[model samples]
Target: MISLTSPVETRAHHWRAGIKLGALCASTLILFFIQNWLFQSAFLALVIVLYLLPGWRFFTHGLKPIKMLWPFIVLVGAWHWWSNELQQGAIIILRLLSMVALANLVTMTTRLSDMIEVVRFLTRPFAKMGFNTRALEIAMALVIRMTPVLIGKGQKLTWAWKARSHRRSGWRILLPFTVLALDDADHVAEALRARGGLTNND
Candidate 1:
């Protein structure tokens, strides 16, 4: 499996995963309380600067994940425009982009194992209450790991559709994408079973 963790090491990589995650949560919460677009824009700029602190190559690599948000950005912009609430829309878009960028930054720097351990620590209380959190942990890890894979697959499907047909490939790709996701899920399930699944004892 291709690792989502960036190969280009930065100072942020040396930071503890728990601290990075805690900061992300706190920053995200504070973002919601701020309603000014200028403030939001400044925050976004600060995030971009933080990304650049890792050097040019790492900064550019960090941006690749943000491209996935273009669709949501466009949709939100359109809705706000239609409602004649452009300022509100801009604030929303900026907030969303900033939060996602911060999250991507954390994921790019932190190792998967570290993030998983943090999650396990967070869920310890629930686990003590007779709730099985092993599956939940596995599911969270899988979702984080598979998101980029699915996005790449969708992009490839779009390109293939474009190559074979002159017409624009729109919703037509959804069926194949769904099938591809299901196929991948089946393979993952098989692999997990072979490895004894995610049993609590394991």
Candidate 2:
């Protein structure tokens, strides 16, 4: 799996996963409750500062996945502009950026194993009550691990299209991308089966 954990070490990396996760949850909930653009902007600026405190390399690495949010941001802004609600739009966009960037920061500084362990510990009571925690843990891990892989594959497909055509790849690559994703999923299923993967009765 391609680890999202940043290579440029920072003090945040040493913090406990549970604590960081807890703070992330609280911050996310707080963001949803805020209606003022001024406060939302302030919170987002603080998040940006937090990203910068880790130095240039770490900041850039953390920023990579956050860039994916741009399309959604643009969509939200356009809808709100058409409705003439720029204040609400600013609040929404700022909140979205702040929350996702903060989550990405946590993911980049924390190990996948550590986050998994944190989830496991938190869900122990439910596990004892008959929930299949192992399946959930495996699902979470695979989602985190495969997300970047899919993103990279999409980029490669886009590049391949660009190399062969004069126009932008745009929606034309969707058919091939869908096929590639299905093929990847088939391979992953086979690999999991080889490892004696989860079943409901497990």
Candidate 3:
């Protein structure tokens, strides 16, 4: 497995990868706006081509996360199907799938350090608006670090519930995860403050 902890070199590499991913996303959205069947077909075909080509890295993660998100995906698909005309529904679903694939590509290829730098630079221009770039950076870092842990915790909670054959719904799974997430976030915030990660004075 490639080490996700290691950093990538240069801002330009980040920009290039981001641009490629963004362009694909933008084009798909544009196609959806036109709401034409031909454009949807073409975009879907291109997505298939992109998936088959090596080094795309998005599909390389290999469907597990997509599988995990299937329930939400189906719910959204149903909403689109019922709320729109047939042509519009098809376009909406295709656009959504394309955007999702591109997002996965961005996360798979982009390094954590580069992502942080991009966030820092992107937020620096907003300093004049009284925004604290340091806080934002720390927040992003915490999110990146804690997201996987949170997901793992949720998965464990689900498994435990299933093992007990409980038919509980909604907050039965959510309340504990929310409490655990909050406690974890509080600990992270304390650790960062101890390290002076939130200092305003440079």
The C-alpha lDDT values of all candidates are 0.90, 0.87, 0.62
- Quote the positional error of residue 74 for candidate 1 in Å: 1.3
Candidate 1: lDDT of 137? 77
- Work out the TM-score per prediction: 0.94, 0.94, 0.72
Model 1 steric clash pairs: none
Error of 2 at 175 (Å): 1.4
- Across 129-183, the per-residue lDDT of candidate 2 in tens digits comes to 8887888888888888888999999999999998999899999999998999899
Runs in model 2 lying further than 4 Å from the true structure: 1-3, 199-202
Itemize residue pairs with steric clashes in candidate 3: none
Candidate 2 residue pairs in clash (backbone atoms < 3 Å): none
What TM-score, to 2 decimals, does candidate 3 have?
Answer: 0.72
Residue 37, model 3: Cα distance from true site in angstroms: 4.5
Q: What's the TM for model 2?
A: 0.94
Deviation in Å, model 1, residue 43 alpha carbon: 0.3
Query: Against the true structure, whose lDDT is highest?
Result: 1
- Candidate 1, position 35, lDDT: 98
- Per-candidate RMSD vs. true structure? 2.0, 2.1, 4.7
- Model 1, 31-110: lDDT tens digits are 99999999999999999999888789988888888888899999999999999999999999999999999998888989
Candidate numbers sorted by TM-score from highest down: 2, 1, 3
Give per-residue CA lDDT, model 3, range 60-141, as digits (tens).
Answer: 4433344555666677678867877666666666666666655544554566666677666677677667777778767766
